[model samples]
Target: MEFFADIADVAQVKEMQEWLPLDGVTTNPTIVARAKKELFTLIEELLAACEGIVQVQTLAYSTEEIVAEAKRLVAVEPSRIIPKIPCTQAGLGAVMRLSKEGLRTTVTGLITVPQGLFAARAGATYVAPYINWVDSMEWSGTEVVAELLAAFEAYGLDTKVIAASVKTARQFRELASLGTNAVTMPPETYKTILEHPLTDKALRNFADNWNGVFQEYKLDSKLKG
Candidate 1:
């Protein structure tokens, strides 16, 4: 499974690079707006820092406009930019066209089995299902994920499912256990997953014991090599 940072902030992106083994960054117009930076410039900077795939969503509505915008975004860094198309009819069409043109695409805004099926049919490299959003509607998001994965396997689709809109560490782990291929969540979610009071306590105990064992020994202050 792969973890992606669902952020556009430069500082948070840098921090993820420093501490987390993230596969890439996921960005939408909303996230871009949060950064208050020039769109392309900010994405380019993020790409430079992470040196991984950066999924940038298209803000256009029509199929032609979506394709055009995706092209422009990919122009920033062709090999690393994966244009994210919404899971609408036009977006699926754009995804099909872009995939045929040899550009990778990620279909986002997915929430049901039909959307996931269409995304896979459109040749999307990744299908992002808003798991948490689905749950908010009193539905089983992981069940949708399972159905999508099952469909992909039965039909021999190569599209990977990216469980998106994750809110908690338990949800993240549940998706991981369900065999999700990827997940993109906020930086805070990533932080929560990496930290625990028990782990901290255990580390402190180890350090204290090691220090006590070597308390009487001291190394020479000078280096001779």
Candidate 2:
């Protein structure tokens, strides 16, 4: 039920924190590059602005390199930085090694039940499934997430499923209904999820009715008297 902002911009992170119940922030190479700041500098700013864990992706492709990079990244903020590793053999190896050191890790680029299970077995704290990518391949991303949830519960795995690449509010709602452990989405998508035309209309109607009856009488004034 955790909502994470999948962004690298510090200002947006601060804004989302103010308006939403944000659990954390997630970032990839693409997101970081878009921020146009030094990697560590941006990470430091994000960690300072975010009140929770910040997922930072590792660029290394080998087990040793990924492990080294992850260790370095977590050293920046041991309590809050979680390394994001790809769902590859090397990445799983790194995750296992890092987990043994009492550090948390996220397994990203996941798309299948078996892959997710394997990441769980490797001691990943979270597994991210690309919802939109799965749907683009003529498959149901929601179904894939549901299967992952069932598998995790059936196996009694502690690893959580964090659905990623969500594009629409309906998709977001579907994942939420399935009780996915967490979801990370862009700020725009989160805004879309929070808004509804009917809700706005209802608010407008309430305001009109209240103004007509109250005639400039404020609720605080009535309460104070």
Candidate achieving the largest lDDT:
2
> Model 2 over residues 10-119: C-alpha lDDT tens digits?
88899988888889999999999999999999989998898898999999999999999999999999989999999999999999999898889999999888999999
- For model 2, state the Cα shift of residue 200 in Å: 0.6
TM-score of each: 0.90, 0.94
Q: How many pairs of residues collide in each model?
A: 0, 0
Winning candidate number (TM-score): 2
Off by over 4 Å in 1: 207-225
Q: What TM-score would you give candidate 1 relative to the actual structure?
A: 0.90
**Residue pair clashes in candidate 2:** none
Task: Report the Cα lDDT for candidate 1.
Answer: 0.89
Candidate 2's TM-score reads: 0.94
